[model samples]
Target: MIHSVGNACSSGEKRVRMPAVAGAFYPADADTLRETVVSFLSEASSAEADKEVQAVIVPHAGYVYSGSTASEAIKAIPSDAVYKRIFLLGPSHRAAFDGASVNNAFDSYATPLGQVKVDREVCEALKHADPVFTYVPEAHAREHCLEVQLPFLQVHLQHVPPIVPVIIGTQDLAKLRRIAQALQPYFTSDNLFVISSDFSHYPSYEDANRVDKATGEAIESGSLRKFLDALEKNARKGVPRLATSACGQSPIAVLLLLMEGRKDLQVRHLAYCNSGDAIYGDKDRVVGYHAFSIVKKAEADAFALTGEERAQLLQIARKSIDYELARKTDLPYDSTKMSPALQQHCGVFVTLHKGGKLRGCIGNLIGFLPLYRLVANMAKLAAFEDPRFYPVKESEMKDIDIEISVLSPLRKIQSIDEFQLGRHGIYIIKGEHRGTFLPQVAEETGWTKEEFLGHCARDKAGLAWNGWKDAELYVYEAIVFGEEK
Candidate 1:
């Protein structure tokens, strides 16, 4: 039976949810809670926060057991990005009901750090959108899954974003689907989703590691079918001793359903550990914890270079090629004349063409260094180091044309439909083999989309002709500029 609490209050009065597990799950004193969270965050390696993160999966366990794993996910939020609202989803451990519970009674959620306001407008809108969403105060009253995540949020996020705290009470897949469908419209770039879960509960340490590894792989694959299949397989292997593969399975399912066809979002595994590894835990029985983040693919135009910037890169490439042909050890360059944009890190390729034919080409797929430095290095390599052709001679310098391709960050695409022959370059990876083709390859060869993907898979990636169907495919756009044009 489900009950709604705090609805009888007056209009002007705000309902506040006082912490239920303050001293038990985490520190009760504000100073201690702050210090504990700070230590966990400080110990975590700062992951590169260059992408726009959309969602994250964190473990909900006692601070002593899973706080370090949770900190990895919270710290992944880019220090610059701010969200207007945070949708907190976690399965109900203490209550059971027919549908999801939205805490309409609470205006703010309180932790030792302070209170975070509830987005009342969003909560009201969700209640109206689906009959499955109810104002069930009891479902959230004693729930620890959602409450444990707040202290970490309070410490990591720049401005503590207002939250719409939800406790998922039903394991019905259809109901979960409907809930995902109802919330689909609100899944925007400015809103963040936090799914709280702990994987593989109460198994022998060895069995827990095996089961959790399979679960993690399925989640990282970004295929809902794979995740469900893996969950079932793991559950079968973990027999009488294992209670469940994941305590928060229902919440994780809802998140997978919500992200079904989103090509822009990519899942990254952040950290993993088990209770047995903790100082307080016994090695005989353990609970597994894993952290992951969903980040948006960086757009092509977000880092576009200005016209003047493009000219400078082209000039640098041309001069470097000429210097290499002249047998000089270094290219002539003036750093004092460089623009600020030249200092930005960017992946670049330098191509040498003569009479409209490809002579030599070389590049760096990942931009680890400054843009200007990459251009200078790749320019010499394209002219002198490309294995397909001999080094360009001084006599041929007058006939050569220099072209530059500046790439946007690569994004993993969900389906072949996401790729356009003339607009997007393709990158394919299967096992240890990898391959790439520029956007211009299609235009120059006049190949259809399928042909372009097939050649890249078979010839370039050394996989079967249809290997892309099962392989990981990434797409990016390039700003192609040449001296002739």
Candidate 2:
């Protein structure tokens, strides 16, 4: 039978869980720690999200190794953001136990930077609410994964809310599901969930890249079965020295369980690298790191771009491809001259047509970078990187026409009745099989609702024509503009 262990809190004395790997994993000095974290955040890519960030998946290795990647993930949370509480979860490398452990006994968690208050009440309630939660001091005694994340939170967030630290010691899916369900009430826009993990431990550089990419894609799919299958597949490949695909598999599974039915939550991959990418590291054996942001996007019609904004995007797209094809420097523009809508982040797709024929198309469903920058990147991809066609040549530039599609956050739909043919685009999902047709696709093809879904399932997602009938359906609207206009 399963059981719980350790008391929620002690009645006798004040308790503060102090740092364990302060001098090792990160700087122990207060000022140095502050400087290091600040540098990481500043040096991270400038692709800050203009969307609401609800959670993040970050690496837990030493600051020198994974700090840049971790900072990239944390940077997704807006600088002016405020939260009610933060739920911190990570796999415990130091202890082996039957269930997960919640930290209720400690009043605060101490790092070199400062002390962050522990949500003792919430922790106690979690312990009482589910047998899957307990207080195992050993689990966190020497754990550096979650502890290292505290400093990033302390330095980045203007108001670092109280945290409820959870350590997962079990690989059991049932137990992880229980933990996710217990924490479901706390997972909301008002709170932030930081999932601490690293990817592809002790694998060769090339193999680590392959394994980590597969694992990241599985996580982005938000399918528990797919994630488990990816892990099993990686193990079966027999990559030399590959100990694990993702060290925080249990915690990630818990997060995926929470995301099982939420369509508004878009998982965006931010950055990736291995220790081999670091300055003082070996390429033979490397540990990989990946950064992801789980955004709770606003409604599909939250805001729309104006005509001027749309025109500006078209100009940017044309220039992006021109610069790339001409082998010139990147397109440059003054940020002050741009509209607020252009600066806001939104998912965008770029389509290219040559002499009124389909040339190339590519896009990200949920983009975290600024609208202007995302459009430029996608435009280049459509012109040069779409795998379906050969790279575009300078001679083809004159005949190329560019079209941009800005998409809103995806929301789950009950039935085809909710999907308007010309106004709403449909995204179909069935297990690992998924595909999408932009809203304009309906207008372009004049396809019926069933035909639209059928084509998308078969041609795009590799599912049977009838596969979308029993699959999970989602609908999103897009703002489309083209150079022809």
Residue pairs with colliding backbones in model 2 are none
Cα lDDT tens digits for candidate 2, 1-485: 10112213333576777778888888888989999999999998887654578789999999989999999998888877888789999998988898999987799877767778998888887877688899998998778888899998888888999998999999988788788767755566677899999999999899999999999999888777899999999999999999999999999998887765455677889999999999987889999999999987575235678888888899888888888877888564456788877876567899999887889998876554678888888988998899999999989888888999998756566688988998987777664565788998887898888899999999887999988888768787888888863
RMSD of 2: 17.7
TM-score of each: 0.60, 0.60
Q: lDDT scores for all predictions?
A: 0.82, 0.84
Residue 66, model 1: lDDT of 97
lDDT of 1 by residue, 1-485 (tens): 11222122333687778778888888888989999999999988765764578889999999999999999998888766778789999988877798899887778887778889998877877787789999776788778898899999898777888999888988888898778866654565677899999998888888888889999999998877788898899877645478888888888888877665455567899999999989999878899999999887663225567888888888898888777766687655777777766765556789899888999998865554567888999998999999999988888888999989987656667798999888998888664567889888899999999999999999889999998888878887888988855
Candidate with the greatest lDDT versus the true structure? 2
Q: Candidate 1: which stretches are off by over 4 Å?
A: 1-12, 238-240, 299-485
**Residue 108, candidate 1: C-alpha displacement in angstroms:** 0.4
Error of 1 at 263 (Å): 0.9
